[model samples]
Target: MKYWNLKKINQSAFEKTGIVPRSMSKLFNRFKQELNPNAEVEALEEFKVAKYQTSTSIKYIIVLLITPILINQLSKISVLDPLVNHLWNKNSNYIFLNPSQEERAFADLQRFEEKLHFEILIGKLDALSAENVNNKMSNKALAIALEYSQESVNAIKNIIADFISIIIFVSIIITNKRQFSILKSFINELIYGLSDTAKAFLIILFTDIFVGFHSPHGWEIVIEAILRHFGLPESRDFIFIFISTFPVILDTIFKYWIFRYLNKISPSAVATYHNMNE
Candidate 1:
């Protein structure tokens, strides 16, 4: 029995449908063009025949909504913030000596800290606010408050990005009825890729949490030790930035590998999905 053959499954699809894939840029443009005001209604009509397809589209929508929530929660873990703050303090002697640069860097850091707090607040509000409450506050007052709030701006950007992703996902499904299996397989790969990425993230998070619980500032000490062993600069700022960003970078690379592996195993699935637009 063949245990795993995404390649064979994809090949069968191609042999059955004879579709050719389009270039990535062209496919992106096509999706952009498909997002007309009437696109939602049209997409619903297109998938009406395949009830499963419609259900899959809804699932994608739910994923889109949930993604930001997950990201917000992860950010609240503040894994990087302490590191960054510690580094800033360590470099303060040198940083303080250069008054001009110090002033600017400090200002920027303050702004960043404020932005982070705002994001945390927005995340809390989004997670908590299921029902729209009627406030007796005037529209002008609310507008003024939002205008001054950086988090409000960030919230809008997140919402816009989420909306666009949902549209693209729905459009892909609606436009490629003939290649539903290919599309479905492609989406499954994406879901799997993200799952793997999340798993890696959780491992790191739990490890950090465990270390933190056992020893205060354990991550910093460990990172500093590693840097010292390597004869590298063990400045708090450098280590902070490195530890804070490295996980995200590593997660991205892992996700890319997952995608590439999926494509390697099922080239025809990707090709069919890509060419379905053509």
Candidate 2:
């Protein structure tokens, strides 16, 4: 039997369409376990399982939080930063991932030029020829180049650090298989054990954030941020396509899970969700 199916018997009373004989058998078994003389032993075993789940969960969280930051700092101190900068700086086009970055660079230079003009207008500086303006713009362009190079190097560091973190994350989950199973079961129980009203509220909240009408706008912003973080081109077409298709697919899968699993496991919660949604 599946490990998560262990709670099936306990929730048999909540089943709206079960055979009488099977229901009686489940009741008898529940009564036997509750009235058993080894109740203390059972309680102690459950406590041990919960302890393992807690420790494993904490380890997971710590690894996720610490590993990437540690790796990033170490890379900056090591040869990683110099090597990436050398390779990246060799290509002039690599300085900016997309035209938006170039536009922002020019905008900053324009602002600096405007400030210089304002200073001259207030008689705070001597009048400048066109050559002086060109020279200042050239210096600003060089500064922008150095800044973009640093950004690209940081993006490379982020990619390496995140990849290593994920490897460690998977290794931990694999090594602590039993504890992972316990944690998974514990989370499932916690969610499914919520009161019907609480369940309905959570369902609405999650759906609104992830699959609601406004979610596409949020998704667009997130996609743009992720692309910019990795020094990738921010393509509007790609963002729009993903926002259109991915959320629809996610919504469909969510509905399928509710119908196939949640409906069978807790029909009352499903009913509550429907009523609240309407």
Candidate 3:
């Protein structure tokens, strides 16, 4: 009677939580004696261990190959150049030899439309705000996007120039270990990435800043030379100089600043603590 009562209590407890009692194995054996018997379970422990081992080995090999290339690539950013030397196959694809990329009056405009939708976005953002605060954000973001596009353009064009500069800088470092040590960290920080509008803005802004003015469509080089040689300043009393220089400088500056600005705006942590201080 006591055994039967204990069995009933155990059954009631198991029913409540759906956990089998220790003695349930005996019940299964009894059933198996009367019925058929075949139990099967496949285990995957060995295969899983082998797969994890192979993955770790492959990751180590990849790191060994990539680390040096990444380190070398990080080392050059500034110093001005004559601009003509930065070429891909002496042109950007078909641009240099056949014709020119920026030769068309509205090349940047049309290209931006196709890939970036930049102008349309700016228009929408501007329409969203009545408050001065909201309006400022719209205008600022619009300007930055425009600038980013331009900077990205200049960065690509100047790729050769940057490469040449890197080679020279690296050579200098290799020859003098002491000098190299002074700038190791700086070299690592020198690689620049610019978005399209930002690139355009920097190219425009710098030309304006350096020579002091802006020209999007682009005056002929001969025409610009004639003006600068004859004494034309951007702000006062000079006709051609202001027209020639301002546009390029402003365009360059806008492009670079906007590119950097937008990069910081995204979720990724920026490189320097100075960005935080600002």
Best by lDDT: 2
RMSD of each: 22.1, 5.5, 28.2
User: What global local distance difference test value does model 3 have?
Assistant: 0.40
* Model 3 collision count: 49
Give the per-residue Cα lDDT of candidate 2 at 235.
80
Angstrom error at residue 202, model 1:
40
What TM-score would every model get versus the actual structure?
A: 0.21, 0.75, 0.18
**Higher-lDDT candidate of 2 and 3:** 2
RMSD of 2: 5.5
lDDT of 3 by residue, 27-88 (tens): 68657755643322111332343343345335543443454344434432332323333532
| lDDT ranking, high to low | 2, 1, 3
Q: Write the per-residue lDDT of candidate 2 for residues 124-216, one digit (tens) a residue.
A: 989989899789878988998878767767777677766776776677678866546555655665676687789889988988899999999
Model 1, runs deviating above 4 Å: 1-49, 93-278
What lDDT would each prediction earn against the true structure?
0.47, 0.73, 0.40
Residue pairs with backbone atoms closer than 3 Å in model 2 (clashes): none
Q: How many backbone clashes does candidate 2 have?
A: 0
- Residue 144, model 2: lDDT of 82
> Which ten contiguous residues of candidate 3 have the minimum total lDDT?
96-105
